[model samples]
Target: MVSWLGHIRRISLTPGANQALLRKRGFPERDLHAKTSLEMAGGSFIEGFGVAAQSSTAAEATVTLARIDGIRRGFAFEGAAMAMAIRDALPLGHRRHVSDLLEAADDHIYMIHVGVGWSFARLPRPLRRAAAAGLTDPTLTWLALDGYGFHQAFFHTDKYVKRQYIDPDPPVPTNHHPEYAPHAIDQGIGRALWFVAGADPNRAVRLIEAFAPRRHEDLFAGLGLAATYAGGAPPEELAELAERAGRHRAALAQGSVFAAEARARAHIAQPHTETAVRAITGLRVTEAAAIATQSRPSGHTVDGQVAFEVWRRRIMRRWATDDTAADGAGAPSTSRQPSTSRQPDTDGVKDGS
Candidate 1:
């Protein structure tokens, strides 16, 4: 009986399939194949969200999530995380649905945490902190903001991408390290450009270049992750992306390594993942994944630096110093320096431009 109520809630709250349609979303139709691929991924996310919302147990949801093969499976897990997060935030008697799902689907932890960010975008402002409070990982929880940033860019391209808007103050829970939120969100927006540009590497590059130079590193990092993980570009295009990364090559490689690790951890095998890894970092998937694993921080902030950024810097440093495939010609001195600007905010629904 309780499961039935869950299903009812899903049916009422989930957006219609049309919402994922590229035409409806007003995204460019640069490549028919890429457009179709992203739209399908979006559909799979909706399907996974509904399945989790309706499931009586995390095990029940895992069964359905496992059946979703290939890269789409990660998106499904992300959607499931969003559903579990929403459930955790509600006044319902059941708690720890997110924790239980993580235990069963540990491989998808990256996607799952990002999915929780989607829940933050959907929930009322007051409930946002409650959702953040439920998540325990200090470093991984920041990925939620990345997810939130992606949601905003994908849904509001005009403002987030075209207008080059940045939230002056994102409403992140105080405990979630609101200071570094914008960088994470920019990473997500950068990732969204892959889809927004219809997987056209050239277009994606142009989009990132339009942003402020300081923002370029994080944006490029996001693009690398999307190009590697979502994988719409062919090998040549991947090479083009790396070349265009220019001074931010280390940042791009860092993001690609992170994506490679996420896919490897989830046991997801995709040709695009390999192609992007090779083109961006000139390393095999295993090699790139190893770098990501080796550089992971202990999840403790040091001198006000978030563990997540620390981990990213470690990866960037490795690529900067050790990566033979990367051209050191114009690499930035640092991946991301501290911004003197005031902290930013994102509502995920607003056209804050």
Candidate 2:
């Protein structure tokens, strides 16, 4: 089954351009607050760009950001502005290391990414409520933040190969996106994705030069993008749990493309659920746990485990004990019972295809 991964666009600002970006993005003044507010609020780093999509199948996974209009607006903005924001926020000067700037900054830029949202116009009566409910999910917030994190990591880590990473810089001034062929325009999708990235028009050119569907595919294949997460873990155990939850999601996609497709459909319902719970509310293990309680519309069942569950179990494994009263073990398995959901065993796990 072919998966429809959305366009995952990442723009890393060239050094020394935060203030310019502030104005482009309409920040009142070049100040730390702009960066802080976005990160704190869990906003997408790239301004003006967003994603949209609608699917009829209950089991389908496709990238939503590819929502393209014949005329593009996001690319119309200047890359220099965003680059400047990153530059000013840092400790480094001309030719200074991006890591130095990030390390020296007040708060490390967490991450930036965007997930597709439901267009009220596109939604039917039923799914519309679900779309509106998704806004509050922490996992949704996590999805939005990743692109920023990816952009910054590349911006700071890579070293300059030649003055220009692209053989020739992008089309001057105007954005040149792909036409007939995909990878052609979105070359930046791969070019900027390398070891290091910065505020170079080449990256921008590579980014908008070709906007293709396959480019998004290339990004997912290149990095093996993991499951989306929303917020922080209170303890090491909780962090582990979140990772495990994401990994379980990843594992399902890996096992069978069909099963992965189904899970992808399920993801639309996930961000909101994970957020509604204040505490860990998933299976003990992503695979093992997800399978234990997975469910379907027809009332079918599948066992499952989640990244969050695995992480939690690793930490609690030593602490957890078997229940002698039920299974004849000494203590009770805290994981077998989830605090977040009503009926732990009622639903099938992520393994359900």
The candidate scoring highest on TM-score is: 1
TM-score of structure candidate 2: 0.21
Worst lDDT run of 10 residues, candidate 2, spans: 172-181
The runs of at least 3 residues in candidate 1 whose Cα sits more than 4 Å from the true structure, single-residue gaps closed, are 173-176, 323-353
Tens-digit lDDT track of model 1 for 235-330: 788877787787777678788999999999999958878877887777778878888898776654745567888788878767655634433323
The superposed Cα distance between candidate 2 and the true structure at residue 31, in angstroms, equals: 18
TM-score of 1: 0.88
41-74: candidate 2 lDDT, tens digit per residue: 2232233221211111111211221232211111
Model 1 lDDT, residue 322, Cα: 63
Look at candidate 1 and tell me the lDDT of residue 307.
80
